[model samples]
Target: MAKKQHYKHNNGAMYLMLSPYLLLLFFFGILPAIMGVLEIPKPSMANANGGWDAFKIVIHDFRFGPALRHVLGFMGIFVPLMIFFVIGMALMLDIKHSPWKKWLRMAYIVPASISGAVAVLVWYVILQPTLSPIKGVLRYFHITESSQIWQQQNLVYILAIMAFFAAAGNWILIQYGSLQSISTEVLEAARVDGASVWQTAIRIKLPLISKYIVYMSVLVFAGGLQIFVEPQLLNGGIYQGIADSWSFDQLSYNLAFMQGDFGGASALSILLLIPSLLGALLVIFKTDMFEGAQGHIKKKDVEIVGI
Candidate 1:
């Protein structure tokens, strides 16, 4: 009776904690997706009266190829670097009795706290050799000219770096917290079994936290596809056409607002969403991520999964 009661209590607490995220996901993610799907069939100038024509128009656009390449390039650099560094730094921080752990955690999140237009402005200044505090370093890298740093070829690398720093801090702390969920007893056993720290982290901790890594990958990939602000702001703020519609998101924005083709935008968004959605479903359903150690899905998880 007591065990059942405790389990129910835990379930309630879990749902309570998840409620805010659920609400946001429903409102911002699911609702928008639904709306985008509906809007896909609506008539539009870009589509010349929409009905999958919007999809054709968007996919066939000249900007589409470059945008896809740019975003793919950003993800190629950002996602791996993010996963590697975030896990590495989190593991480094999780070392027992590390004196600087708390300070380092705080340092990691400071950049994340600086957000929105401010982050854009800050990055702009930082990337500019003449204005940046690290001008000497920029010059060392042969980026003395804004022309050098802001070129078409260098934009992918630049965007990747900017996105990585902006996001890595928060992910590091999240992954670190995930690390803390690991059983100290298990870690002790690993040590007792002559497993070195590296071996334990690689062989034990990494596998234990694999689900979180998948979650991060899905979100990171989705966010990478939705890259808009950096390219858009950079284009408008400094160089007028350098990264103009350099991402699919920017292209969608231009289609909807500039070109007055909401249907095309919605179709494009749906097309972009398919990969992230499929990837998430594959990870979630194929793995035993939501299952308990007993090889059954937990009741709470089952209920959520059903929904």
Candidate 2:
């Protein structure tokens, strides 16, 4: 009873401390989400379902279709590949006696830190045939012009690579940290059962950290869906309308600022947000991730008692 009370008191104090940030989140994040629902464009007198008609307009628009395809394709590539590499690298990195571990961790982080405009510039230089170190490879593929490389169809691969480098490093370290939490006792028992190194990692280590991976996947999907800066900077920076409205976010930006269609922008935003919200709920329920989170809170409570 005393421990429960102390735990409640500590949590209450923490929440109290966090109130300001929570308030700001409500004002900025939650408030806009709520407002977006109401701000969906209202249709004309001819259309009976005004909001639905407006939403349909945004959906059926020519630009919306291409942007939709681009985002879906981008997510398809980025999500699976990112998960595979992050997990594989993290598992390899967890090797007990690896001397390169410390330096390798730094190596992952450094590239990840070079993000946003810098990443765009870095990738641009690398892709630019005259400037690239891989100019020989480009020429061998018979690529001579920027147009050959920067085609609309190839943006999927281009953006995926940029997004991967921008994010995969941090996720590798995060997955590595999750790998560290696997109990040594369980691992020893696996060894006693004659499990090889790869076998132990597959059968023992992965399941323990699976929830974190699911959580990471959910967030990555959400982030990829909201992709803007990469395509935006590419189009706006140098290419000038080459990738204009290449993503949902870019389309939404055009609706709001360029076209002055706030309602359409809000409608588009709501549409994009739906999948993210559903993905989060799916993770929480389908994986029982919320239940696992409760255990973490209990673990913290036990730690407080030890203190």
Q: Estimate candidate 1's alpha-carbon lDDT, on a 0 to 1 scale.
A: 0.85
> Candidate 2 lDDT, tens digit per residue, 194-261?
99999988989999999888999999999999999889999999788778999999999988898777
lDDT of each: 0.85, 0.86
> Per-residue alpha-carbon lDDT of model 1 for 25-144, expressed as tens digits?
999988988898999878877666558777777899998998889988988999999999999988888777576778888999988876556677887788888899888899888887
Give the true-structure RMSD of model 1.
5.8
RMSD of each: 5.8, 6.2
Pairs of colliding residues, candidate 2: none
Structural RMSD, model 2: 6.2
